[model samples]
Target chain A: MTDTEPRKESVSCPMDFILRMLMGPWTTYILYNLKTHGPQRFGELKRRVAGISAKMLTERLRTLEGAGLLRRDYEATIPPKVTYSLTKRGHELDGVLGSLAEVGARWEAEDAAARSQRAAESKSAELRAAE
Target chain B: MTDTEPRKESVSCPMDFILRMLMGPWTTYILYNLKTHGPQRFGELKRRVAGISAKMLTERLRTLEGAGLLRRDYEATIPPKVTYSLTKRGHELDGVLGSLAEVGARWEAEDAAARSQRAAESKSAELRAAE
Candidate 1:
């Protein structure tokens, strides 16, 4: 039982590896942006993924590229332009991200409801204490 | 626009923070086990979550407890026994986790199909090169 937790060194189970790759803070946002908006340059991706930093976005892009999930194209010019888009392999993950997005929406609703309930309960508790 | 990234300090968007909370490698597994198996002891949790070690499991449990996602009940006995289960807030996350699990299954199937397709294409290319 090698249960002591291994490093993220090339996950052996293919699907697990793939899922973990997209498990980053900005991963789903980035992937969804690519799927919905098509190919985008580096700064375009940064803008679309909400809270991603330049360094983190760059690191994430490199990881995705290394894992064969995305393809990068560079155009030669005075200032080089780099564009990234999903590869065939990455496109396969869209269905997965789609499913997650649906769940995320539900969680948003439920969490809101829970917070309201708590607020109500808190107010009642305060009234009782005052009485 | 605060273009610079902030640390994961106190996630502002409740959903974003919560999602990030459950985004750890072994998180879903731990929660799923709790949902399916009901409240269990520390050792049981350790066994159920495939790759979690004692130290990491302790850390995660403490984090979840601190976040109000789980409740810890300690039975005062000859030896200590600690049991953990989901809070109402954590139960609310079930819908989200369920959605993710469905997507995870889809990704598994798609990865298999894609690998087969690639293997076939590679063989075809090899044969063409030989010719």
Candidate 2:
């Protein structure tokens, strides 16, 4: 639907809905990890997404599952193994993720350049003051 | 830099940086509005981005400005008008935003279809119970 459409009965704006789906702290990271590394167990995901607490990881996983982005598979085994993989819908985000990564890389480069410029300016200022 | 690069002095990951820039409430909305409607005054933006508090709007604007995504113009007028517009970098996000909107539209359609199916199922269950 276009942005101008009347939404008197809609639950939420499409933009808002997608943003909500993606706004969770570790949501994108978790999705990225799953997409890149394929299906992984809970513990493996936890390790791959560094600095994420177990509580946060579990919550984000449930959110992603609820949103139909990923599937949880239960394997009958001696230890009861569980794996997570992106569903078809989840894999649909590949394009967006790739774009985001490219943008992120450009931003990183710009930031690095800015930082170096500022450092050089400061160094020159100090040298001029000493002279 | 590639993901495999070992950075001994990096400030943050590129993914983390872009995510941080986009994660703030009303950020993407404001950007989308500006991109679609062209430059807008502060008050106009505040109104267009519904539900955003003045304080929050100000914070997001500053963040966007700091990140070089948008530019703020101060026009010396009777009341000192300030306008915000997307910078070249901000405009670079058009492709990403377009993709997001498309994905969001698809998600909304899927959600609506699911709701209808559930409603139909519940109605059938009710009819069966009545019989």
- Top candidate (DockQ): 2
Candidate 1's C-alpha runs over 4 A off are A1-19, A28-39, A47-53, A65-73, A85-131, B1-14, B121-131
Chain A only: TM-score per candidate: 0.74, 0.82
lDDT of 1 by residue, B1-131 (tens): 17634653332233344556676776666777788889989999997775678999988888888877889999999799999999886786666556455555666677699999999999999999999
User: Looking at candidate 1, what is the lDDT of residue A129?
Assistant: 100
TM-score of chain B of each: 0.79, 0.84
Residues B1-131, candidate 2: write the lDDT tens digits.
Answer: 37763441233335656766777867888887898899999999988777688999999999999988999999899999999999999988888878877898998888899999999999999999999
Q: Could you tell me the lDDT of residue A61 within candidate 2?
A: 89
Which portions of model 2 miss their true places by more than 4 Å?
Answer: A1-13, A76-78, A114-131, B1-13, B125-131
| Clashing pairs in model 1, backbone N/Cα/C closer than 3 A | none
True contacts kept of each: 0.08, 0.41
